[model samples]
Target: MPHFRIETNVPKSKIPQDFVSKAIPVLAKALGKPEQYCVVSLIAEVPMNFGGSTDPCAIGNLMSIGALGVEQNKKHAKVLFELVERELGVPQDRMYITFQDEPTGNVGFKGTTFHSLFG
Candidate 1:
């Protein structure tokens, strides 16, 4: 499972209608995961201050069972940042993204943990 969640100061109306749609494929391709298992969410119009400015900025979190590390995350950051900037007008310099490698045992799906299913 891979989840990409972004919270931005950009207003909802300013967010493109195809933002999530565009992000899904990008995230899936970057993580080498199936599009069906990828989740992308955007919370727009958030009250956020970055570097003491209320300008267009975002905080992103990416959680996945695998496919996350220094090199991989660097690639993901590049692709995802481009998508955000193109769709939400949030510059890459104004955003920060954090990555997390989730434990399969801690994530459940279809009434059972992924560890139980995969292990």
Candidate 2:
């Protein structure tokens, strides 16, 4: 089975349960894998300024979600953007998301080893 990893840049204080509930299923569906087979890891970063004019409030609320090597990372990127926009009330342009592919062995799941270890 293909492995998947999700690295999110949200506030450390933010509840992981919130992200996990939404993210796990999205990754599983996007990667065409069973939800139970997927692994998710999150890395929270302190909020940072985006520079230039936009919305200070929005900039302060910036977050990034990175999904590593699913079947359709790019497509999932779009989905993630939309999801953040709707969930967090941040504009699509204000949020950032990305996906990358790694060597098969570089990622793992569960006790068997996959992209990440969520459970």
Candidate 3:
């Protein structure tokens, strides 16, 4: 599972209508995952601040099972920054993206942890 979430101070009305739809493919390719297994969520028009200012900024988190590393994260961050800039006009410098590598034992699906399925 590669779950990506966006929390931004930008107004939803200012965002492109097809932004979310366009993001699916970008996210999948960024993570080297199939689109069907990826999840993208947006929490827009929310209060956010960075460097003690309420400028147009975003804090994003991507949680996933494997497929995360320094180089991969750098690449993902680049695409994410472009996306945020396109949708919210938030500069890359004003945005932050965090990648969390969740182990299978810690991620559960159905009635059991993903670790159990492979074991």
- Among these predictions, the greatest lDDT belongs to 1
Q: Clash pairs of candidate 3?
A: none
State the lDDT of candidate 3 residue by residue for 12-118, as single tens digits.
88888887778889899988889987888888988888899998989889998988999988888888889889877998888888899999999888799879986
Write model 1 residue lDDT over 1-119, tens digit each, in one string.
Answer: 89999999999889989889888999999999999999999998999999999999999999999899999998999999999898899989999999999999988999999999996
lDDT of 2 by residue, 36-94 (tens): 75555544453444445344113211112223445555576666666655644456665
lDDT of 3: 0.87
The alpha-carbon RMSD values of the candidates against the true structure, listed in the order shown, are 0.8, 6.9, 1.5
Cα RMSD (Å) between model 2 and the true structure? 6.9
**Model 1 stretches astray by more than 4 angstroms:** none
TM per candidate comes to 0.97, 0.55, 0.90
Error of 1 at 98 (Å): 0.3
- Could you tell me which residue pairs clash in candidate 2? 107-114, 108-113, 108-114, 108-115, 109-113, 109-114
**C-alpha displacement of 96 in model 3, angstroms?**
0.9
> Could you tell me which 10 consecutive residues in candidate 3 have the lowest summed lDDT?
110-119
